[model samples]
Target: MDLDALVGRARSLAGGGATRTVLGLAGPPGAGKSTLAQTLTAALGDAAAYVPLDGFHLSNAQLDRLGLRSRKGSEPSFDVRGYEALLRRLVGEPAREAYVPDFDRSLDEPVAARHLVPAGARLLVTEGNYLACDLPGWREARGLMAEVWYVDAAADLRDARLMRRHTGFGRDEAAARAWIDGNDRPNAELVERSRDRCDLVVTSLAG
Candidate 1:
């Protein structure tokens, strides 16, 4: 994958009219969507901003109350309506500065206003596991994007990355494997089904 070419494409997206253009990155867990989105935003500097869907993760308390702790990363575990509203605000109010939330892996919680989309930003780069999902709330979010890119990676590579991520965040190897099999794998499969709905497929950043 040519990083320069990808940057060039992002630059083109940032060169549009006064209305903010949202570029969404959709992929399964550990597919490098966040990495690519951050890279593009960094390269574009003030012209681009990033918003991640992981920010809409329901709190652990909410998950436990709803009996969804074991399925924490699943579609139902997210506040999809909140995510949709954020996207709508970002697209509808380009001239206004907006605060963006983010999920903190260290705290294993969602933090409020960890990022800001400045009024000068012309392009907004958002990435997540379910951006291309065909579900009701997700479909509304996708409709606001100027384009969505499906990030892809090899199964083995994704599994390896997920294992590292889980263990790094306090899960034991056995627990990590079980969670991946029970939760992440199913979510990945569901996201894969929506790949055809994306405007582009991105494998360049998979590595």
Candidate 2:
């Protein structure tokens, strides 16, 4: 679907007495969830705000302590409960502004309160891999969203994009490939299994 169509549907969910209408974009790694979230937020102007669940990525230190640093992007490496609480605040307290953390890919860490959702924003866009997962916190997160869209792409294309991202963020070519093959691909498979749970399935998003 076109950007306008997506915006229209999101807008429709925000009218009348609604407090905050959340449009969830769920997908496997490299499926363009971040791209769609940014595009929709920009297209919707001040009416929309973005809160990525990636912002809740556990710190590298915490990951090391948990012995999960090698599998950083996996679901267990995130602060799922924290992300869920932030979602609740977005929909529950419409009259108050919410400060949201942002994930810095360059630093591979989460920066606190880097983005804010103003009280006037009618729509909130949240994107992540686990939004539609049937796992504990994810199922509750899915229930919190007004609508969920599953972003998808061909496997080869997705793998290529992920490799580029990993290298750009600092890994060497071989390390990036190993991480993608061993860690990311498994997480992608887990995410894809929940595709049918989303309200819509979007194969490709425009540049």
Candidate 3:
């Protein structure tokens, strides 16, 4: 579907004049989920807010302590319970502003409370790789959302985007490819399995 159609769907879920509504964007890494989430928030203006799940990644120190530095982006490396709690607060306490974390790619770390969802924000767009996951904390997190849209693109395109992302973030070309093949490809496969769980499968947002 196109941008207008996606926006229309989100608007309906927002319920116009009712309580806060959350729209989740789930897809594998490099699937353009963040791009779509940001675009929707820009289109909807103040009525909407974007809160990304990557913001809940565990600290590098924590990863090192847990001996998971080599598998940095794996599900076990994230603060899934913390993410669930944030969603709960957002859904249950609509009258208050909630502070959400944001991941800083440059530092490869999470910056605390960098994103604020104002009480007036009726639509919250949260994008990430694991929103549709059936794991303990992840399943409950998905249940909290009003709806989840799974963004998708050609496999080659996703691979290209991921290669550029890793290289841009500091890895050399060889390392980038290696990481994608060894670490990210497996995660992508797992995310692909969760596509059936999403409310919508967004193939494109070209309109």
TM-score of each: 0.96, 0.96, 0.95
Cα lDDT of model 2 by residue, 139-206, tens digit: 88888889999999988889889988999999999999999999999999999999999999987673
lDDT of 3 by residue, 1-207 (tens): 767888888877773564787899999888899889999988888788889999988999999999988888888888988988888888777778888899999999999889889887889999999899888899989888999989998888899899989999999999999999998898889899999999999984432
Ranking by TM-score: 2, 1, 3
Model 3: per-residue Cα lDDT at residue 63: 94
Residue 176, model 3: lDDT of: 97
lDDT for each residue of candidate 1 in 4-107, tens digit (9 for 90 to 100): 88788877877356788888999999899999999999999999999999899999999999999999989999999999999888888988999999999999
lDDT of residue 177 for candidate 3: 92
Poorest 10 consecutive residues of model 1 by lDDT?
9-18
Residue pairs clashing, model 2: none
Q: Kindly report which residue pairs in candidate 1 clash with one another.
A: none
lDDT of 1: 0.91
> Which is the better candidate, 2 or 3, if ranked by TM-score?
2
Error of 2 at 38 (Å): 0.7
